[model samples]
Target chain A: MGRLRPGHLVEAGFWLGLCLFLYVYSFEFDKNIEIYKFGASGWPRAIILLMAIAAIGQLIHHYVKGDETSSQIISAAVDDGSEEAAHAAHHETVKWYLSTFALLAIPFIYMRVPEWIAGTSEPGDAGLHTARLIVAAILIAVVVYFIRHHRVRVMLMLPLFFAALLEDFGFYALAPFFIIGVMYLFGERRPRPMVLIMALIFGFMLTMFVKILYVGLPVGNIEPFYSIGSWVVTVLQ
Target chain B: MDAFNNFLQGSITLFSDPINILIFLGGVIGGMLFGAIPGVSMLTLAAILLPFTAHLSAEQGIMLFSVMYCTGVYGGAITAILFNIPGAPENAPTAFDGYPMTKNGQAGKAVGAAVMCSALGGVVSTIIMMAATAPIADWAISAFGPPEIFALVFFGLAVAASVGAKTFWKGWLSILIGLMIAVVGLDPVGGIERYDFDMPYLLAGIHFIPTILGFFAVSEIFVQAEKKVRGSYKAPKLSVDFPSLSELFAHKFAVIRSIVIGFFCGILPGIGATLAAFMGYNEAVRWSKTPEEFGKGKLEGVISSETANNAATGAAMIPLLALGLPGGALTAMMVGVFQMHDMQPGPLVFLTSADLVWVVFAAMFYANCSILLIGFLETKTIINLLRIPFQFLAPLILLLATVGAYAVRGLTIDIVVMFLAGVVGFFLRRSGYSIAGIVLGLILGKIGEQTFAQAMQMLHFEWSGFFDRPIALGLLIAGFLTLCGSIYGAFFKKAKTPQTPDPDSA
Candidate 1:
């Protein structure tokens, strides 16, 4: 037991946990008609056994044949203190990761929480999408607050998330405008030519994929959005 | 002779189409460009182009893409020899010898030898691919079953175990970790979610792109980021050279040896071009009259390495087409594209799309020819990729990584998975565990599962019934030997004098 390595210990611990969880999986599986002499549990049980052997094998190999200690591996990793120094010295966008985590967490909440209470007005607007928008708004507002408070890791999520959404809203026409807005915001305040670049890119993509391939896009009631393609489809029809 | 006639006909058709000619040229050019640009990986290029060619005849589409694969591998040597930055993994062996040639004022000669040797190996492997494919496909079709597939996966895992790192235990650990991750999403048997905890997207299992990108590409980023911050980042002088015929003829046997090594390596199933190149170089160094001149400027060095790398391309495609086991990462992408095109890739595919497979073989031929022609022409210009500033280029690649991951399944969850995987990969890589095994594992996991699960059903879940199939037993034995051989080779090989950094590269 003492011969076990930290790696194996951790791995074995995981396996032990996984074995317990397989019990939950068993509930969903067929209990009728044992396929093997051991039933369906035969293979998964064998897998657990293999995991234990592998962990033990690792422990024995390291303890018996190896000479280097854990400190050597640790030192080899931490020897480069320069990276941490660089990060410290060049630190600017502080709330970047915070916003990213919040955004990721909001989606998880949406998956589980049917009636979340964050906005001034409850997103209990009696729709699935309404809940999503409210969650997005909360995520965006929380991120913006942190970005303003800390002023590092420049939170670029608000612009990027909204822009990607615009492509869905049938402002399929306004998609390029979104890129320009995001690019300018990302570029830190010069959003003009970047906006134009987005327009050019959208036009190019539209001509290439949509026009040439005859694929349709969601024009989302944005009236100016659906024109040439719709007319072409009509002509063909 | 019928197969030979088919190849000749493929060649004939290759010349008949001017559009194909332009594609061949474009492939060569694009290959060189992508190879020289360190962040623009061939897998990314192959994956992106896979969908765009949906309308083309299978042979034409394959011909276009194979050109990209073969040339990309060859094109990487330009940067390796000129800038000392191996633009691709297989090119790492070239930088060892080719950059030394540049320092000795024979950059052109090194490049020439590399191109020529790559051509020689490619032609040999292409011929071998054409010849061996039918027989292998026949046997593979006859033997294909669940037990057989499980045996193949075991063998693949063994290859990863034996070849991964110094310690066999860590390699096994790496494989296990990959298998665990692969178990995420739906259980293959009844489509029950195993690790997803009830998420909707998890029901389909983890889309492979995120896993592969995490294991290979993102992990690479983590490694680069950490190393870039501390290492003395130097670039090689962009001196270009091509070797004379005499210099190449002297190494003709070396080229043959490397191609043989590459073919065998590809047949083994999971290990890819990098190993083939490394193995070829090691053998060249071992057998050379002046073994001392290996890591220094040697025409034979670049020749031996590039030839094997390119040869592996055709070699890898064999199993993917025949048995539906993807030969490597690029082949896996091709398999995905094949599925997207509504063509199942295994033996049944032979009966359904025999003509399409021939088209693929035909495309492989033209692509090989294109690599030979345009690869040489693009060498002089490949050095400009290093000119891009690191600060700007790194994030651009990260953004592309996000886009690439998202494109796979049209999910933001993929992007998040990609980001997390990248970070995990970075640590695994620095710690010396092979990421290759992990990627191979994730890709092979489902294939392994379906095969294993099916075998279970076939046997009436009998434990002893799995080995009843001669083919399954044969594959098991082969896998065991391969695993043992790789471990013996990697661990027992004597260390040479530790290599120093190339001054020209610095």
Candidate 2:
């Protein structure tokens, strides 16, 4: 038998452990509900059994496939990479990790903010939810700059920063800034038409969503936004 | 002729009121915008707008929701065609053919074909729903029970066999994982929590909308990010080339067949436009003379899926209006809208609110017309989405997807869960697992479990009693046949020549 790679072995172990956890968890399912003939645990146990069967099947497939082909393929691929290619691959891997980190951390930050703001056990209390979305976007930009290519990182910064300010500044306050940030990120140095379109879009959103539809737009977290929102709502009504 | 006069009366009533016209227009435009935007689902928009409709008169309220319902299904195909990112899950199939066509610089033709076929399907199904509501409702009411529903869902899972994954076993494994995820909440029959791990969020169960946003939109964002890192990404030209009239006429039979498939699938309780789209696409592939052209940008593939999904819109109302049973989630929300207006659906609703029913029928017709008009107008602008730098557009999609996930339940956990699901989905797609198969499994698993448990309880847990119900037995046989066919196709089909891609391969 060909020796299995450590990665394949680790994968097999992971599935096996997962199946064991599911099996153990199935036992904790309560079964006392009178309406159910076989109780709640019965279905879960049946599912767990099927899952165990599948896990075993997965293990065998992995072992046999690994023995037949994967090792040879990996060896051939590894042999083909030159020094420059190897360096590029390492760089790509770093970028991948950076992107993944941003993806994962932003959600964590967003989840944790409500608890900090409201002193509540709930991780995303309603009061802090929208605010946290903005903060998370800002954090994502900041975090990406530290780990990502500088050019790409610069592109991510402006839009994310403007998005972070959207809740505090409201539609009228943030719309032009967002458009400007987008154009700058895309390297649009000619800004006259961009500004014109942004003005029209903001007008459209204000009329359509705020005045006509009455959707709950956060009238900026500050005074002018509140006054603008009040003026728009009153005028429309 | 009496039906004709009632229809005319309803049309007049609907068109005569300026407010009603405004309501219909709002629903169509709003529904389409929601549908086209990534993360905004038809159900979510319908739910949001539903509360506002309470103040309107019953006719206006129903008209508003009805137009929203019809146009929402039509709206997602635009984004699906332009970007490979499907605005809704059902539109994913459209992206297979539609996006490829866009890549070939025929986005105009693709969107035009999709719009024409979708409108055709919607108009045809609305007519059928208006004409055959009673008869179809009678059949559905008699044929469907818990056992039958369970069997139908089981048959739906058999679709995993046809999803053309690299490995059929991987697809099955994905389905199993989805099913397990579905069972994580309370047991439907016993009302006892199964897999909450003592978390309050898990106790309510996994919401499918957020899960869908994760699987389709967020996952695509991750894939795009990876591509940007690899420096292999290029934005497509945004110009759309409209299809010639002859091209639209060419797929006449496929459109009709898809409409039938879509309507029947929609009539079945719990089955929705997503399944209809899949089954319709599959059936078109089954019958096509040039089946190999399907995923590579065939017009028939686009038409079949779009027509079937929209056809489902009208047929879905059949069960709701005729029997008071919601055919799917959107209609279930519509049922709430009806109840808020002191109206109830079902047979009595027809007798008591006959004119209102006709008005709804008229509204649907108007909605389909609006889909054609507004869809044509928007295609130029929507196609220009491909012109935006992919790097810029990717972040925008991420923003919309986050908002969509949050909008579903107003929970931060949902957004977190969506991101997690995206990470998982990214790997699953890379490994050639069937993302569609897993999504189907997730959507149908809860319904299957609930119905199966109900059937078991009804039969006192005598497993053999399932076969006693003729409808259930027939559906079970169908499920078995589909599974066997998949296994045969997987193992027994001839290997392709090295240079040629298999027609069935994703």
Candidate 3:
């Protein structure tokens, strides 16, 4: 009925492909369970089928109503007519796409970085820990140096980097840097206020999460950072 | 009479302990503060606190969440009235009239009416919840077998999928994705693994907490980050002038109707306060003598929305407490709390943990009552927190979300899951998918599978057995009709309407 947007086609295609892949994968489940008539795969298969149908329906709908953007639909649901939704509806630039890609890479980096570093070493090897600490230092330095220039992209990538290094660097060592980095990216330029606010937030977090709740936050496995984290806990206790 | 006595006993037990009183106050204040902050949902705070709740006594913990539920629903109204930024999605409707009133320099009256109406709605709904829950649980326990339970879950999932999405298909697809996520672990009925892919972590199933933190908190941060990148809003001036008793009394009918609408909406398995507020505002407009006054600084608009959303908070607990079907994401998190405390929510909770349930009831009642005083006194003070920029708040939220996800199972993998879920959730939200539907589907999926297995066993593998059970049959019919209706609305009904070219298309 109307000209279809390429974005809608891609989205529909992604859902369809995902649903089909899962449907095929569902067949791998053991089907010969003695107690129940519907086997283990039955429930998943049903869901996969439903998902496939929905995806196809979405494709059809996209074909029929090609002009309606997802943001418009969301605005309709929100019904606020706010400027925020209007801004969100605007076409994304290459910067937005790159930042999104970087954001999506966070979990992969978190999972794979250690594996890449360890490289056939046993878990908790001394040498491996030393290697991880050295690499972490280098990476942190690079991130800190680049963050000012690539604020949004680096900010997007910071969480996983923080998470990955959290155990080795400890919460105390990394948290302030994380806070300062984010605040800086957020356009907090004045050094005095940034440091003061960071200290306040850091103190509050230390008192609340670690001291009061006993949340077992990671105190680094490596030196200096580990000692700092332990020292803070000791003082609070 | 028994319920009344239990409620009184609960109140006495709650007020007797100084620590509990402190916890009650803390929860109310904390809930409101968190709820009032733009870019932070109550779910984020709930998830962050979920790990710590394990340490408190079950009554104290559950009571805390119940109190938070009430205040969090009301807290967003202040920001909506003053700044035009709803602290939560449920408060979005409040800004329609509330912000308009602020533009007209009636900000005080708008905020006051919102405060009073929110409390009134919450108090009335809590009373109704106290009366309704036990009977509903008892009836459900007795009348609902596995087949009927499955049917009910089906109906709930169907209704959930059809609500919030631009197209019904997207909503259904979101639920299907959630169901798919739920199917990842070992099959509940049989010991057979379905999608674990030989991973030890996958065997235990994906914990909903990290998934929720990612979806609600992390994904929200990304969305907000994008918004910040685009542009930002300015802070508003702080002042509140409460309306007189006579002024409030004039719109009594609107208040009553919203309470009713909110309560019924709340009792539904998947619908939550956001929809209730919108429905309430819509109904208020429909019933008003001069409907044009709505969305143009009408006091009734603020009153209806604030009232209904808070009203839904208490009523939402009904389905959660009675059937273990969470009315929204926060209630789903409550299910996590229940599991942590070695308690199953459904009907047996009424028998085994009646005191806990009653305490929650008492806490909600007190919490709602406290909102009137606290809302009146602390509106200006609370709005000050909004001055903190979204950029500063964003990273802090991410850090908290990290701890929250990691704290749940002490698994680093879960943190990864949280980030992955966040990225996916952002994309999904951008595509008009319902996050609530997916979350509900994930919860309901597990229950539905288990019940379906049990029902099949009971029926000796006879597929037709579902048709024999009247309740099951009825629920199935309802589910089917809902799907059919949604399909018609999405496809056939829309086909009949005149199409206009979207300006963005050009």
Candidate closest to the true structure, highest DockQ: 3
* lDDT accuracy of residue B414 in candidate 3: 81
Q: Assess chain B of each prediction and give its TM-score.
A: 0.88, 0.69, 0.95
Task: Give model 1's docking category.
Answer: incorrect
Q: Per-residue CA lDDT of candidate 3, range A27-98, in tens?
A: 788577888777888888888888888988888878876634332122333322222442464524545666
Ranking by lDDT: 3, 2, 1
User: Which model is ahead, 1 or 2, in terms of TM-score?
Assistant: 1
Model 2 TM-score on a 0 to 1 scale = 0.67
What is the CAPRI rating of model 2's predicted complex? incorrect
lDDT of 1 by residue, A1-237 (tens): 445455545545655566567545655542333333444333444554555555555555555544222211111111122233234434213353345445535434543443444333342243534555556457556655654433212222332343234332343444554444334323324455554555566665556545665544444322233464355445533
DockQ of each: 0.13, 0.14, 0.40
Query: Candidate 3 regions off by >4 Å?
Result: A67-95, A102-118, A130-138, A141-146, B494-506
Q: lDDT of each structure?
A: 0.61, 0.65, 0.79
Summarize candidate 3's per-residue lDDT along B1-506 as a digit string, tens digits.
99889999999999999999999998999889888887776767886777678878888888888898889888878778777777776787888788878777788889899889999999999999999999999999989889998888898888777666657888889888888899988887778877888789998888888888888787777676656655666666556788999988999999999999999888887767877888898889889999877777889999999999998998899988988878777887788788888887888999998889998999999999999999888887886777877766876787788878877777766877787788677667766777777888887788888888899899988979987899999999999998888787776553321111121222
Write model 2 residue lDDT over B196-254, tens digit each, in one string: 99999999788765676666565555544444444442454576566777987888888
